[model samples]
Target: MLRPEIARSWWRSEMSGLSPEAPNLRVEPDAVDRRSRLAAAAEPVLAELAEQLGDDGFCVLFTDRESRIVDMPIGAGQLRDRLEGLGVVAGGVFLEETTGTNSIATAHELRRGVAVHGEEHYLEPFKRFSCYGHPIIHPVTRRLVGVLDITCDTGNDSPLLAPLIARAARDIEERLLQSTRRAEQRMLAAFQAAAAGRSRPVLVLGEGVVLANPSAVELLDPVDHIRLRELAVGIVHRGIGSPPPHTVRSVELASGREVSVRFQAVAPGAEGVLFEFDKPDGTGATARIVGSARRPGVRTTEPVPGMPVYVGGEPGTGRTRTVQSLVDGGRTRIVTLEASEVAVHGETAWLADLESTADDQPALLVVEDVQLLPDTCAVRLRRLIERPGLWIALTGAPLAELTGQGAALAAACPAHIDLPTLRERTEELPELVRAMLDSLGAGDRLRFTPAALAALAGHPWPGNLSELNAVVRAVAGHRSVGDITPWDLPEGYRISPRRRSMTPLERAEHDAIAAALRECGGNKLHAAKRLGISRTTLYNRMRTLQITT
Candidate 1:
């Protein structure tokens, strides 16, 4: 049987070109000197190696970028003088050509382990020492940073020593990688915590938001994180199309400096697009959520008791506000988890947006835009709903198709509510307008004339409640009290009688199904309930309306 030491020596000799004829003895001088130099940051590791390798058996050395001996834990003795004479001093740098027989020089050049035994040193003095060494890498960046080496007199060189050194290097690399991953995790946690309870501008690229932090949001124009990503994509798309003189580029603020943005495409199979932003200034601007107007006849309301309720309507229909009201009312503890944010949990606990939250505690899991939930998340949600305690709510706009997943979601819920658009519920215009004005502190003092109310109510509010709120606020801020009129409304909100046309009943049915689907959180079963019909009837209506599901 091969003794562990002999096997190690043989392996090193074969792999590193070290000679087996090297002297077999020990040198305490070099080893003690190396240990003392390593006593600062690497003391524990040096001590451990010493205890395991025996006195004078092993010495640890640290090298700089130029492969110069920066520190070492080797003892002072005659052999040390011989090694020093061989140009192994603190300032002596080594390279493959310069130190032909040194393991440190060879390992640094080859980016691998190396061993130099007796007679292998190009210089006669170093022929008395045998060296084993490996390159070190940055813990986080994974870049080659330095080297660690162990050396002993040729007389003490043993076969097992090479393998021991290699094992130690491998252990250190593993620790470095682990530490890097942990630091990344901590940074991500801090960012998320800072984002909580704050309305930061966010731009969703593909799977995750590229700039969701308060600083990023505040510095950029007011745009939803998702919209920001879309804008970025649009810019890229435009750049590809027109080939403008100034290439469309993203700018990021880092460390109180503005820098151009750059991105490298990740593998197609990667979870999300990786974006690197330019460094910005340390100080960040305040962030605010930009919103549009509500579409006509769109109504918004918080969910009530019985079973969990989902309210669906077009964008700017006040879905966020409705959810916020529920949270404020103590009806539920709302955890609004956005689908665009990528959060990595352990493999077993990993979940997409709709599937987040493993808590058994009573709370409302509010997912925005159910249509965007990844398939994995949807499936996870299905499983979660099987158990009790938690309520799931979602919001989204009209989907062009609702098959497979659309059908699946339709069957999952029991309650769904459709919010009427502003156009459909024009009779409530005065009330909504008044409420919005009062909320803005304008009250009855800042009233709109009948003509202005009529004009506002007549326009097709493509943005729904959100649009109405903005118009009211704008009029309040810009128009003098008791002088509000139809002419006071923004140019975009002006009504055109010629544009009005009655939609066919089939079209109405389609709209109702689509709206109900959104309200029911994309659950067909709950949509049917909201529509006051059986699931079969809903399916039939969907088919007749030429809706795909």
Candidate 2:
């Protein structure tokens, strides 16, 4: 009898118009490359499993979640040909949608071990072999990454195939989880180092939070975690120009005193915040902490009035600041039009004033979020584009994205510059941060450690300069005055796992297990025999080497 789940999956396949009579052997090359990491990691484990079934007439198959055959090693040549003839070789797709309900895809669909024999197979071509498959689950995430299968002629079916495939999948999961444990350990160590010597509460952001020395972790409610993450993401990357006053403003703890927190970059999306509550040393004179201030990266010349200017960038990317710098030394009548406003109201507000202006007058018209400029506004704006003594600056999405409909608007304002994200300007970060701090009056008071700078540079800045600016402002406002170490930054940034050194015996065992598994075609039984140890002993050692299945 077909299992209820298999029956449903078969129905799903039928609904999708898959015919059981026709199974194609076409392989997707892209799928193989996409699963390179999984294949590389599972190579030894697969070889070991294949060795154990060496003469047992079972062929091992590995496939990605898409059911594209990634790797396979067969026992009997004739059986291999039979199965390969039915689209069972590497690159063959076996999902219900592709090949109808079969063990490899069905077990993946069920996300568990399953043994399908003869008539249980939805596709007639697959009924030639009995197959057992188990989904290779991600240990940390508990998501199915791929499937492991053992296939044999119907007469060679054994109850042990399910357990064997399941164990192999578990083995793969264990290896995957090892990486997670290593990452978590590094995060914990970094948090510990950064949190040391600080009296303030230090919260490290990641997939979850890790608190440092003085912080009472219990005080942080689950809701606070969500709120803090949202605040951090919004402030830097989410196009939020500024954090709400309630979020960045000092919060009054239950102790009847206000505590100010500084959010520093952990990675990019993550942040570590240091809290300062009623510190006797609290003496910040500036109401707005300094973000990065440019020391004129561009040498300014006198603006030739009537020269068309187009400034373009995402929100908070120094485009407006650059424009202001260009107009600093002159009396250019500046009029700003927010394209978003125009787009919303369906009209440009400054068009009347712009129309009345004398042609020879020196003027700067800045359009913010110019990508939002409507078709009608683009038409009106074009009329003013060729006016004498007028300069137009624009900022918005990339020109390529604007080409479809906003091409005319772009053509109207010819000068274009694309601002690079913060990740692209790591070299400038240190100087920018320091200069901004000096301007904020904290240059003499604080310095960032090499580790801190390294952490900052490594971040993939999704929010660009604005996020970095917020980070600098935060550090100045709340960080303890001194060299900013990696710990002083976010926990995520400080993560560096200590390299583990294996003992001589462990080294020997690792080498031996690896060699034995290879020589035995990954058959643990023969490998155990070759190593002169019991199969269980071999299993234990493979686990030690992280190669067991």
Candidate 3:
């Protein structure tokens, strides 16, 4: 066996001439500890090593810092018995100078692997055992952490064992690093969710909450939100914990409240804490309604005053409220038309849809289910949009077949808006509920249970905002208490049954349109810009695709 002093000299040689100021010369104690823990937990790796070396009369063992054997491969029973007979025990530490064996001693001394075959062991009892071993390092920080050893009967010693053992150790380290990275990513995603209005409010304490995103400020009190330092201090003080290092506490909020606070240690000297809070119930109603208001022919911006704005969305997506918000109860001569039934009027009667000249006052012409219009009516209606004083807004479900109709309207006015699905705008649901409750005069008294919010969030709102609103209204009307629980939701609203007719292609197109509209905030003109087409062309495609606005 190599001398312990010689191995130490070799390790010193590896670190020779390293300047303390060098960026790469940093040391991490926690990384070393984590690697050690990983090595202790590596059951699969140990099993693999056993399979590869057992037939050759070899057994694999993992050791902790003090050299105590913490783990052994399952198939190494006989070898383990032999080692125990040779004075190796679970709590007994093995090292070079003490045991006079190359495997453990050389590994510790050199901070790497070593092999001692047959007679190389100074101790006669170990002479029959040939061993190969290597030090395992932390994959991320590259710090030596633990040792892996493979031992076999003296007759089984071979040249290949040393390198094989080293490679196995490296693989374990890599896995450890990968696991660490994935965990960090998950934590970061959770933090971001809180920062955005999408998740419970969260306050990050380390490094002043790192308010890198716009929504991070929303977590703080209105006055405190702008000051990063103040926000951090508040989180540190009000956070559920006793103090910086030993604090651990949890508090349950009123129903509908969502918040998560965490204190995580990134590294030995780098730690961060996070505090998150979800909005009170009903705060997201307007945003949800707006999200669902995107329809192919809807106009986001009012190009002219007193123009009827049309909105199309799935059955429940907010269509009416959004339009009302735009009108702001103005006396702009509003005319509403629903496509539930179509009346065959004269060609000249189509002119009635336009702003009348009785007082020359501009009119807002809101048309719903433009898809239901007969071809002739659609064409004539398209002609009326050409009149300079008329403002027309149209909304409908997937109407790709109405591309020609859309093209005609596009020729008159190119602007259009497409709303997002309820699923896409789930982040805004809580706020929407709050807004709706307040509008219904339940602002101070209304609240939702955690289960209710979770159900709402998980549901794929087929009808969009309209459905959400109806459910909320129903719950509020039926419930006697302030809290609305998931049980209070309309029957089957949370469950989506299997439907066989929906083809994959149709789903893909719907998803694509929904995604595009979300990215463009339901602006048809912007969505058209992204699709590399004119507003008119987009309308035609929407018609062809049977996509409602």
Candidate 4:
């Protein structure tokens, strides 16, 4: 006769195909982000709890959202070693699916405090231990940050374990709230100091917070705020140590007025950037800051006198936009046609549209997704691209990867610019995230914590810029104002991959194989049988895919 929660956990464990006789206690080594806001908040609290628990056999364990042990501050040397042998040390995973029913996993699963003792454990290996666990939810986002657990031998189990774990969890949550409040306070103080006189337009920008002096508000519109923010974000990402000398940038506002902005950090250890704006003197040579246009890692092609241009990159790498930027007057000076329309509108209609657009205007003729063009249409298009006084540009896959007539069309364009994938441009993520927020109209109201930015950088953005933009838009819609923490990110984005990213089909196959291995307690032969693959094939796939059992 067990408690209802324990009975439910046992049922889930059985359904997970975990064996009561021999549990799968092996855990892989994971590199946790020590700079995480959650980790920062919980470390001190766990340390204090550890001293109180002492060498009295009780141990305190802190885990991240994924249930990987982040720290074990209280365990004795012998006990710590024993747990390490069972993969319970720092950086080791203790999820229910992998480790069977226990307090840490069960508390996370049930979203509450839980206690498990003696034979009540789902697996025999865990039967001699007693544990109390509680999930720590973010005070603002109300998302699970991690879990706190207290464990000891059953013989040394104390009635105080449950209460102690709950208190520690609450303490971590409170610290998280206080950390956000303190950051906002520091930003406000810095803003006040900078905006005291308001001689010129002054603005302080931080996560979920924006401050503007009266002069600033009067001189700027919503669009101006975004542009100024982009400039600040770019400067900050370049590296903000001791307050660097103010740098001036000429930026065009939405109202069509160009202003020179002075940018610097708000304060050391503060979470925002400070900006002051003034009209530029007509004589001073000013460098223009054009948001993502000036961002690093994105290659730009200069327009040749009469030669056509070719811009190539993966989808969402801003191919068409890059070409438009090269023309004298941006998109206004370009007549755009999508080669992909050849499939829907038929090649004849598509070709006719391209010819008419090229003949009708003196504008630059731009063909987008030219890789999708039919061979016949592509061949005809090459002639139009080669015509004198008709400047043309093509945006699509790299020239070397193109085939047949498409390759010929690209070869005719003498100027080529290749853009790198988003993953290769991780150093630009901070500025890119801010610029995107500005474009999405949330720049002034939202900012990411350094920890959150680090988490984002760790991901290998397989979907490139489009995926990143979608994730940012989704995260933006949820929080109106305040700094975004890593916990606030979507769960999938938060996952630190243990291996290289896989395609959807490969991921599904990988998941099936991993599940089978887990169900069979890491027995290769049995898992292979369950997955309907030979053991030799399983071994080869495991090696090729970098799956560790």
Give the number of the best model, judged by TM-score: 4
Residue-by-residue lDDT tens digits, candidate 4, 293-353: 5345655555564579888888887786677677666535667888878889998889888
Best by lDDT: 4
Model 1 poorest 10 in a row by lDDT: 264-273
Q: How far in Å is the alpha carbon of 364 misplaced in model 3? A: 1.7
C-alpha RMSD values across all candidates: 26.6, 19.7, 20.1, 10.2
Q: Give the TM-score of candidate 2.
A: 0.41
Quality of model 3 by C-alpha lDDT: 0.55
Q: What are the per-model numbers of colliding residue pairs?
A: 64, 11, 54, 1
Point out where model 2 deviates above 4 Å: 1-18, 27-81, 90-98, 107-111, 117-120, 136-146, 152-160, 168-306, 311-334, 338-363, 368-391, 394-549
User: How far in Å is the alpha carbon of 410 misplaced in model 3?
Assistant: 4.8
Residue runs of model 1 more than 4 Å from their true location after superposition? 1-306, 324-328, 342-356, 360-362, 398-401, 496-549
Clashing pairs in 4: 208-482
lDDT of 4: 0.74
TM-score of 1: 0.34
lDDT of each: 0.54, 0.61, 0.55, 0.74
Candidate 1 residues 1-549, lDDT tens each?
544433443343333222333321112233222322122334455567767866565567767545667666554356566666555667555654234446777677667777777666544556678888887765544456567788888878887877877776666666655544544444354345545565533222332123346545454432122222433442322222332222235442211233444432222221122233443544442222112123233333324543455556667766677555455366666677655442344323446324436463447776666655567766776676556667766665433334565436535756554555555555456657778888988785776654466466446577778888888888888865775755688876554221122354654676778788877665665777888997657755654444432
